[model samples]
Target: MRIGSAASLDELFDLVLEAAHEAVGYESASLMTVDPAGDALTVRASRPGRLVGTRVPVGPSISWQTLERREPIIIEGPADKALGTTYTKDVPFSICLPMMVAAKTHGVLNVNRTAHPGSDVPLFLRILADQAAFAIERMELYGDLQHFTGQLLSQDEEHRRRLARDLHDGLAPILVSAHAQLQSAGVENEQVDKATALLRRAIRETREILGTVRPATLDDLGLVAAISAAAREMATESGWTLEEALDDPGPLSREAESTLYRVAVEALNNVKKHAAAHEVRLALLKNEDTLEIDVADDGHGFETEQWGEAGVRPGHFGLLGMRERVAFLGGLCKVQSKPGEGTTVRIVVPRDRLR
Candidate 1:
């Protein structure tokens, strides 16, 4: 297997070791991962298997020197003096290759043999170590990206919650109180009546804004009820026949619930705005270990390829936003549409991740 094709760090390490063994036919080999502090190396994968998890400090050793110099070190004859008695003392020859890429050292790969393999073996081992290093670096960078995305989504949700709370607890109540006072005064003037009507309208609009920011039904009732309420409201406004088959997904983490709810609402909004169809269907179901949300509209759909083009097009931002939101939760969002045909937006998330 190519080191670059490795899906995980562990798999990469194993592949690197296997490649080294195949290149030189070493009697024993070990792959060690550098700790975060760069102060020690731990044997993550070894041909003998028993050496796995063994930790060695990065002192004045050949492995440490190789990592520091970012080069390969070859030791011929007995390595008892170079490598401590605890490691490869009786091996007649050995090579330590630094696994490094972009000036960052990831670990060291060591191969030991009972006799000298040949001068050319070190070159092959160096190339293998370089590939392994690049793969390891890529995996670490991807992990960092995932972590950053999670944090960004969490912060965005918190901001939305705060804004919704202020509108509900601060602005909405003031409008309600003003309207109540006007009604209680029983003013018998045209101006007073108009003022009361305006206040009532303001209060209603404020509540709508609050709901749009963050729906209380999601927190009070659950995801299913919130989605059902949203779909019904959209259908009523759009004069579309609404069909729902929502199965209560029990409970979910706040983040999971919010992500799914937002995606569903976005899909519905797209249908209301773009899909000129007379009917729409929304379904929520549990398929074994996965939860799925489907929204379909029999509207005048466009080419689905235009959804994720280079430049922004009509409805591209919303679709991209929905996809990103679901992706952050390790879920998938798919939109299918064609001219003269309807559009279907499907989202699937792992059940375990919901918790």
Candidate 2:
């Protein structure tokens, strides 16, 4: 009953196993959680604590059957005759209940007792398993919420840094030169002209900063044209060969356009900063219901294994932002690279999701 107040999955598992052993009198019990890949379930907590972290394939196991049916099952007689499995056959009575969250079976809770249990055992155990399922689902949603909040905070800090750099490098010098010219009492026509030119450069720099915040071209020319112009700009600035093949996917929602544009910008910036490549390629293609933006470079690649759990490199904060942006649009972002080879980043979103 107190399982609802558990703080983490580990704590919940421990509480559930203990409750089942003490209150339910199951004698032995275990809780297993499905892996993210959905291929296997690992024992998260067991009464004996010996089978913790033990993973078993889901193929043809009673746990798999329970998951498939999305219900609880009971077995009588010997373990081999009851469950048809060599593993854990010594236990005479067994019951397995699927842990469900919003119609999805996330895992299974298994209990074993010596004698044949009545119907009340399964019912009582199912109630406890439901509590555990709700706790796990809540924890998963809370974790996702925390991750997105962190992503937003990271983006806010990055934006501040970019603005600071823009002012220091571009506009500050122009203002200093203008101030110096004004301080001189004997200012000539040439001095006035020079000051005027510096003022114009300052205006241009400010406009560039605004553009960096949110490109006016994205709203004016649309996603495809905006991406093409950005690609050309990057190639000109870096002096790298640029290849582009953009298929007009028609008009997308403003959110989709912005997300795709930002992802492309991040990819191109990475190429400029990290990739010492002589050539780069960008392509936007629409196939059926999917729209894909692909960027590839000939630069020296990195080890793909360095990517963390979310498919973004640990120190590459920009890539993480790109992934978060794509995910918000209900899309997938993939980055692949291998040492001595090259690197490619792809962003794929569904057409319907864009709308």
**Strongest candidate by TM-score:** 1
**Whole-model Cα lDDT of every candidate shown, in order:** 0.80, 0.78
Residue-level lDDT of model 2, residues 127-160, one tens digit each, is 8888889889868866774564444335764564
List the candidate 1 regions with Cα displacement exceeding 4 Å.
80-88, 155-355
Cα RMSD of all models vs. native, in order, equals: 19.9, 23.4
Give per-candidate clash totals.
Answer: 0, 0
The parts of candidate 2 lying over 4 Å away from their true place are: 79-84, 157-355
Write the residue-wise lDDT of candidate 1 on 1-355 in tens digits. 4887888888888988888877778888999989998789999999888999998896877788788878897887655574553343468888999988868899999998886758788888888888888788878966874554344346676676776676668877777787778888977899688767767665655544443455557888688988999999999999999998988787788878978898899899999999887999999998888999999999998787763563234212467667777888888988888998999999999898998
All candidates: TM-score: 0.45, 0.44
